[model samples]
Each structure stands twice: as C-alpha cells, then as structure tokens.
Target: MGGLLLNCDIGESYGAWTMGLDAEVMPYIDCANIACGFHAGDPSVMRKTVALAVAHDVTIGAHPAYPDLVGFGRRSMVCSAQEIQDLLHYQIGALDGVCRAQGAKVSYVKPHGALYNDMMANPAQLRAVVEAIARYNPQMPLMLLAMRDNAAAQAIADEFGVTLWFEAFADRAYDALGRLVSRNLPGAVHHDPETIISQALTLSRGEALIASDGSELLLAAQTLCVHGDNASSIAAVQRIRQALGKTSAS
Candidate 1:
C-alpha cells in the first residue's frame, strides 16, 4: 500500500452564513471538492474557493448535488435517468465554468449528499451519473464510496471508460458490509482527533477497521474524505498526513 490521497468537501457556505474552515483545511488535503451551488455554495464563494485551492496547489474536483438547496441536497429526489443526466450536466457545467474562470480545471466529479448515496445502490442512477460524466469529459475520474464486497459501481465505471476512486470517510462509522452507518444511528460519527487518526492509519495501511457489527470489512481505497463541517477536522487531517508521511519515510 502506498500513501492515499486525502480529499475534503468545501465551499459549502451560503450568503450571510459560514460553513467549513476552507483555508485552514486546504493545506492538509490533496483534493478539494468545491460545491457547485446546488447544495450550499454561491457563485462568489465558488470562485473564491477555486482560487484558494489553486493557491494551495490542491487538486480541484466538482461536488455536484441535487437541486435541493433547502434540504442541503440530502433528501432523495425522484428522478428518471434522463432527468439525472440533465442535472449532472448542469451541475458539472456550472463548476467547470467556475474552474475555467479561476484558471484551474475540474479534475474529477463527486456527487454530493443524497445523490451520492442513491448512486451507490441504484444501477440506473449510477449509469446516469457515469453517462453524464462521460458526456462532459470522458477522461475525468468519478469518486465513489468504498464498497466492501460489491463491484457494481466499479463495473459501471469500467463500462463507461471512466476511472473510479473509492473514497473512505474519516468521520463516519461503517457497518459490517463496509457501507456508511446511517447518520440517524448513534455513534455514526467520530469527532475525536485520536480516534480519527487511528482509523485513518488503519485505512492507509490497507487494514480493515472493525465495523459496527464487529466484523472486519476491507476497503482498498485511493482516497480518504475528511468532512469540512467538523471543527477539529483540520487538526485531524494534519495528524493523519503526518502519520502517513512518517510511515512512508520509514
């Protein structure tokens, strides 16, 4: 196993409101998934975020969610394949415009919130997303959750000629099947820095962490996600980066 890329969801703030500490968190992440207005970002925020990411020499990715601003794109929307494809194109195009304006390029696409979860289990939704990405830029990679035993999503990505990066969460707990434990459940999130650091180490070492059911679920991931909403997340990322650096040096 080699060092894994660390990514974070950012630029989530809306007008007259603040969200994640983007500046503080940027130095620790390899990739920055900037929200494309659908979930929680506005035009001004998106531009500023892209510039900041460029300044920090981080890879920029598009984080597109459903067109549900009020629900923060966390509520499932009933959408047909065509509808999903259209939404994906619209959102990716929005981010591409911002990235172009900022003298940067959107290197990948990561569906945000509910749309992301829906695509995990629904082949139709996955195809829609893959098709949208292929239509926009066939070379761009698709970011997806790390699955324990299933290869459906990966298969879809392969069929579409799109590279896939399996993403593991730093703050979220996992079930035995390697799926994220429902947020509605207790102990779904780990906010403690030490705990997060330990989990990250396990992931980086290609070891399986104990899931909620006490079963070991292996995940070979290329990227790890640190939530921007957590206050201590920056510190946690720093700790994980330092740990990985030391391991690599040794």
Candidate 2:
C-alpha cells in the first residue's frame, strides 16, 4: 500500500453543456484532472476550473483526451504513436499554460476516456503517452488505471523516467482482470454511499475485491478517482472523504 489520494475528473462542461458539479466536488478532492478543451472543456471553462481548483487549494492535473468531442472522448480512434504523443503534448500544454496563469502548475497528467483505456491495453499507445509525458515534463507524474499487471506498465514508465501514479475508481466495478467494467454493463458503477466508502477503506487497507466475474481483483492504487459527471456524485465524494479522513486520523 501507498499514500492515498482522492482525485476527480472535473471541468467537463463545454460551451453550453454543463457536465459536472465542479464547484461542489472541488473541495473534497486532493487533485483535479481538468479537461484540456479537446474532450469536454472550452477556454472559459478551463479558466474557471483552474480558478476553482486554486480556490480549493487542490493539486491541478492535466486531463488530456483524444479529439472526440462528439463521443465525449469515449470512442476509440486509430492513430500512429507519433500522433498520440503529439495530441497528448498539445492537450497537456493547454492545461499547463492555464495553470501557470493562476500560479498553479500542472502536477500530473491523466489521459481521458478512450485514450486512457487504449494506453492500458495497448503497448504502443502506452509508450506514446509515457514518452509524451517524459518529453513535456519528466517530473510530471502520469496517471494510469490500477491493475494487477502494473509492474509491466511501471517498467515502461520507468524506461521513460516518468513516475506512474496508479488510480482506482471509487465507485466503479472492476472485471476479473482488474480492469474497469465496461460502462454498458449492468452494475458497472456502484451508487450506494456505504458501498463506495467500504470499497475505499478496503483499498486503503491493501485488500482486493471480488470482480464481476467472481474472481479476485487487485486494485492497488495511490489515488482513488470519483467521477463528478453523474448526479449525487458530489455527495458520494464527500462521504468517501470523511471516511478516509477518519482512517488517516486512526
């Protein structure tokens, strides 16, 4: 086990499509992975999110995604590794520039949606993202989904001299292989408050969970992510934070 951090995917709102409870969820998280304009944010939205994170004294992170504004970056795309690296660099720079304006810099980078999934399952894409992170700022940590097979991923990150931050879903279900269950699946997300808190506590204690396939899933993580897009997501984060606080005190 390692130090625990609560993080959230935030600043997803676009021009007129408000997507998340950014203001309500900012205070409960340790880090904010703000959208970098390609997937879900605009210039004004990015600025607002940066200001909100600064106001809450939260660590700022870049949430870069594939250029799929229509599918909300959830749909996978086919591109070369060089292209992946370039787009990632572009998105990260966008957020980094925004944070610098507010005297808060990007401390880490987390690829959003399809890009994130692609990196987890595809070696070429993973290398591309890690390479981009290393080239842009070696000190900036790259966030990846926590899994039983992170040793291999860690090795690739180490090759680039990029720090790997394993992250887990606080309210989402996992498959037998420790990957997140597809969103289309039933019971893919746990909405019950107590269940979410219990899962968080179990992870803090270095325990594994039974996956959807009735197999053990190791979700070792340094950070737990709570999605803020859905309703009541803010309350869920609040409760989980309180539970984590008590664990820290004890």
TM-score of each: 0.95, 0.95
lDDT of 2 by residue, 19-100 (tens): 8888888878888999999889998999999999998788889999999999999999998999998998899888888888
In model 2, the Cα lDDT at residue 139 comes to 95
Candidate 2, residue 129: Cα displacement in angstroms equals 0.4
lDDT by residue (tens digit), candidate 1, 39-131 = 889999999999989998889899999999999999999999999988888877888898898788999999999999999878899999999
Give per-residue lDDT, candidate 2, residue 21: 85
Q: Give the TM-score of candidate 1.
A: 0.95
Candidate 2: segments with Cα more than 4 A from true spot: 246-250
Give per-model CA RMSD: 2.5, 2.4
Error of 2 at 89 (Å): 0.9
- Please give the range of 10 consecutive residues that has the lowest summed lDDT in model 1: 241-250
Candidate 1 ranges with C-alpha deviation above 4 Å: 246-250
